[model samples]
Target: MTETMDRNFIWDFIEDDLANNPGMKVHTRFPPEPNGYLHIGHCKALCVDFGTARKFGGVCNLRMDDTNPAKEDTEYVDAIMEDIHWLGFNWDDRFFYGSDYFEKDYELAVGLIKKGLAYVCELSAEQFRDPQYCGDLTHPAVSPWRDRPIAESLDLFERMKNGEFPEGKYTLRAKIDLASGNFCMRDPVIYRIKYVEHHRQGTKWCIFPMYDFAHPIQDALENITHSLCSLEYEIHRPLYNWVRDNVDLPGNPVGFPRQIEFARLNITYTVLSKRFLRGLVEGGVVDGWDDPRMPTLCGLRRRGYTASSILDFIGRTGVAKSDSLVDIRQLEACLRDELNATAPRRIAVQKPIKVIVDNYPADKTEYFEVSNNPQDSEAGTRKVAFTRELWIDEDDFAEVPPPKFFRMKPEGEVRLMGAYIVKCNEVIKNTDGSVKEIHCTADLETGNGMPADGRKIKGTIHWLSAAHCEDVTLHLYNNLTTLENPSAKPDDKDYTDFINPESKIVVEHAKVEPPLKDAKVGEQFQFVRTGYFCKDTKYPNTFNRIVTLKDSFK
Candidate 1:
């Protein structure tokens, strides 16, 4: 069982329900539409759904809400399952598809017609939205076919199911109050005629049931005790109850499920809309849905985010009734905190510049032992080669000393990490006036120790033996958009306009210690002062910088 100290208003309600109704099983379901890949925004709901069930020692079913097949695909179904499993949750044998209840949805619609609770409306979708038919707050909506006889409505609905009418020619609307204060209660269309073939059901269904009509029925049939969903569906709760009150469902031991809504996750500088993400994939703006820069779960996984770190983040965020924009840095902090202690240390020189230990014996090589993870005592140590020729990051040296520069400089002393105190005595320049190499004399007596003269070395820089290192490609990722809230951009500007141009920077031929040569795909490492990196899952000899060491979130 998963242990959590986190508590929210939802838990209070569930506790009350359990108390009032003894022997109540806290069964829940996570029903995702198979239209697009899951994103970080969905992680919140996933945790609440599966986490709540686990907390109560109950079961959670995984259902694909494939009611709308226009944009749905089997690919999304497989991806959804994979993502859920990767997040360390499972539904076991209780997997289902919304289309599995299509025939039952049709039967329920016919029953609603016979009970004078629904009717076959002739108004086109566009015409129904016209002010004359969709009344304002002061006026009630008008429908010419609201009074159509049940016999004729049933025949038309049946024919509509059999493809007798063209798309949008007929619709099955719940016969709710047209004058209700809530707009959703005003004769909402529960079923619409669509000629598109379903991904799972194929051509067997042409007239499809709307989400509001199909969802509650599926919950009741599955005996779901609580239908936890996002706050956007709060207004639709009345309609959800209306269906359960009217439909004479089969033997459901749990009666009807209660629908609960909570705030959805919104992160600054990120867009969670699948429609927008799909546009980016189709327009070639990103490599694909799993691009490291995208916010999709698969993208984050490929970029080196761990499931435990993500879950810890969700737990800290807590559940709220009102929506709020979370700083993306908080998410980064969680990853950084976990990786700092768990990831083994490795040396990687980005934008390398050669360094020669002029005083060291050129024919000899020594091994220096360095802690794999300073934060983890049991992680132990690994030996790194120390040779006469070394590679260090170009930034570690400055040709002209800046104010209070502490790293490598002409005639300045610095510590080569895990090795020795070295003093730069001369700089070798290329024809272009760039520093081609730095020549330093190592105080061999101070190997990983202070100098004998008690001189302070203010800077320590990581380096790899030039002859013992391997070249690798590095991918550094930043925020996808420059704007803090791309969804709130000005009316005239598209969200895509704010896409950060430098979101991903690729560095080719970066040098790493030989130990990394055998690093397997998806292995994470702390690149000693560079950042945390993970071996690329898609490309060979490539590592993606997961996040820098700095913590910006307060």
Candidate 2:
């Protein structure tokens, strides 16, 4: 069942499914709980559901499993929709919510009670807390109230629905098995008494169905053929099918949705769980959910990631059953590959140092013709302002550079990106002993973007006019968690405790070209030698680093 997927294997599976029932319609669904923003892992399942359906000429549904009321929110639903659209998926009008079947679900629960197949149990939270509550392979402990009369059960269930019972007083349990080999088959709770108001359903349902019991029925109700999911739901498939078989569904008996499990996406040095991600945000380890340093979809967007690149990445990951961790570099490689062809290039400086063109006239300012994006011939060219005093990265020049250093050093000549070839004459020192400025002489005749004719320079450094520079905020992002694998850690030390506080560092003094002053919030731009950065939604004045220029940090 877990063999490697090849072209032959894929065709074989499709042929088998087609041969099994020639007329059966193929339908798939991407069901997500609206608790938090979707991560990169969710993208894997998304591609499988929608991609598979489209390939097979079937329909795919975008369903929200809004079962738990406490963590779910309208904001999450909106975010999820936005992400799906950003990923280029159109559900048309097939968007469905689990809470939409409230009335029908209640009738089904009542039907089970009437058949004596389900009983309302009065087990307290303390009972389940014990390790021995779920008995071993040979023995299974029966709840004392398991044999309560159906009349009393129905009466108590009605009272439970009437709001007479407290939150945990009564729960509807399926009488599937008390001594079955499967632990989940041991009379699992079908419905729990939750008194909280749902985000979508409001206070209409106090007795809500458990996810394990409701998911399969809901899938069947919507005529979902393939319930695509992560590997984690592998064990829950049996329980998923059992609920559909026992309960009477709407219309035909075509509600037996086949559960298909694929490998969950795992990225190196990235913590993908919502709870751990929430901890990093709530604990102030990172800025917020959309912080470019974080791995949430919002964060990735804020970090200047393109939706097409993400889709391309998921496609490259392929469909497989083996669980494995993806190197973060591979993800970045996809990003760089896409951005290199799409994003226009611009020169910006981070730690600007003043370079005085002593030879050039002090008042003169001009624009140097530069390639907008070298990779894109259609991108054409743009103009950059070159002034008497220009700003260059502090690291570009070394007062006492190494013997073979090719950049700006004393008596060394380097092209000023779009401007002139300049030679450092003198280094000015500040009161604090830091290099305040470097005086240089630019050959006005050779100040063109590239070297004149066959003339050459050892290196070309990027620079912006100091007199025309605009202050831009910069956010340098790092991994959210310090631990490589937080999920594999011991239970004692909270994973949140290991969160790196320095995940995101804000740079308020970074300088940029005047052309970028109008860059809107969440916009992306290539920072020349720096990296791809997006306009921070939280701080519209700044840009956040998504990934470096290269995919590999090494």
Candidate 3:
């Protein structure tokens, strides 16, 4: 039975249903409004919707809930599809749009009116919200038009659809309750006059159904077994059922689609609200929706986050009824765990300090063997050039050493990783009072073999040979906002006010091994002790730091 598969309440309910009915496959749908780019928040819903069906050998429909056409666009529709596909879910041929069922939705509305369950009201938008007429549905003032003849409502509704009346002239509302405590049941507006063209159905109709009205009908028409949605829509469930039970919908998940709710995903230092994300893009606080620093899925992808890593992150954040904020490190940790095993190893020095092996032959350059990935021996090995002149990180050397600073200093010994151990003998200073270069001599006996005394080196640092190094740009990123919950800040303060000023920093003078110069876009590599990096999508010879070596995300 499906109940034995998982302990989540949603699957439990489905299991019980399948057990009693026998031979009914679970069906689900992910209905997204095509208004803006999808952010990480949507990933949670996608997992539930598609994953549940996949678990039961069932099907999930990808529906565009594009009823409100005023802000919808084809660009957003395309992006949504691209992001979902990138997330490793395929809806196949079971795709739909709410506008595709608009005519059927209208017919259902007319059926409700003819049955005296709905009516057209002349009250302005503000009047519906008045204390006397709304809210206290237990003792509410009924609209004057509520008691009008059904014929009058049907006529007005037909006219509304025909554009005979101007926008805001009237609205068709459900005559559900005048005394119900739930506000959603208190004669909610079903359809409103909108004199705008829809992205898919242009100028074909003047009135459009509100989201509350269209959503359930769309689900019913598609015969979704479980109408899964975020917890924010829990209160809207009653209305979801009202439309399901009131209007006749074909097929069965034992009567009508059961609306199930789960918590949405929220991460610290990231805002997932499309409206707020749009502000960041429009205000230029970030580049665009796909900016590597943004939290949008495209942005994460652009930052080299893998679909498998995202799925693993979501798995770590199991499904629950109550909402909670996850630390961003959990996501980064998943990437680290993955890249640590799969990424090829390479040597890169971002802040280079020149080092001359004074005792070694000046024109000498030899190839030293290095493992591509120590975690996976099948990854093979690559050769790195060992030379008399090399580039090591500027921070690796200190003119005046601190306690236990074992990397490099005057007369300090450190192993140049994959090559010979070297001792810094002299420090050359520039006229500006800065260390210009460090002169070192290689221990001839330590080259590619053990010393006779078997002495151990305490510190090993990566180095790039000057003759074989390629200059590459590195893009490092930080949290976009200073506050963990920027969206929850005081009403008077804009989210942009919390934007981290140093969100993205570029190191244009970084040096890596020559082989890295031919790294194709989207290829990932581990820069020895530095961090995991991926070739940038838009920049040649540039890499985006995916995640640092250490996990500091608390």
24: Cα error in model 2, Å: 1.6
Cα error of candidate 2 at position 546, Å? 2.6
Q: Runs in model 1 with CA error above 4 Å?
A: 1-5, 250-255
The clash numbers for all candidates, in the given order, read 0, 0, 3
Compared to the true structure, candidate 1 yields what TM-score? 0.97
All candidates: TM-score:
0.97, 0.92, 0.95
TM-score of 3: 0.95
Over 1-554, each residue of candidate 1 has an lDDT whose tens digit, in order, gives 14422888888989988988888889999999999999998989999999899988899999999999999999999999999999999999999999999989999999999999999999987888899999999999999999999999999999998898899899999999999989999999999999898998889989999999999999998989999999999999999999987888866544358999999998989989899899999999999999988999999999999988888888878889999888899899999999998999898999999999999999989999999999999999999999999999999999887998999999999999988999999999999999889999999999978888898999999998988999999999999999897658899988888999999999999999887878999999999889999999898999999998787577
Ranking of all candidate structures by their TM-score, best first: 1, 3, 2
Q: Where does candidate 2 stray beyond 4 Å?
A: 1-15, 250-255, 449-456
> Evaluated with TM-score, which candidate comes out highest?
1
Evaluate all candidate structures by whole-model CA lDDT and list the values in order: 0.91, 0.80, 0.87
Ranking by lDDT: 1, 3, 2
Better of 1 and 3 by lDDT: 1
* Candidate 3 residue-wise lDDT, 421-518, digit = tens: 99999888899988788899889888766656888778889999998999999999889888896547898887777888888989988999888899
* Local accuracy of candidate 2 as per-residue lDDT tens digits, 1-554: 11111232333465567677677677888888998888888887777777777777888999899978988999999999998888787899999998988778778888888888888898877775444666778878477778878888888877877788788888988888888888788888888888898998788778888888778878888888777778888878888887787788755334347777778888877878888887777887676777777778877887888887777777666777778877777778888887788787877788888999998888888888889888899999987887888889988988888777889998878888767888888999999989999999887778675545666798888998888879988888877677776557678887776677777777877888777888887667788999987777776678788778875443
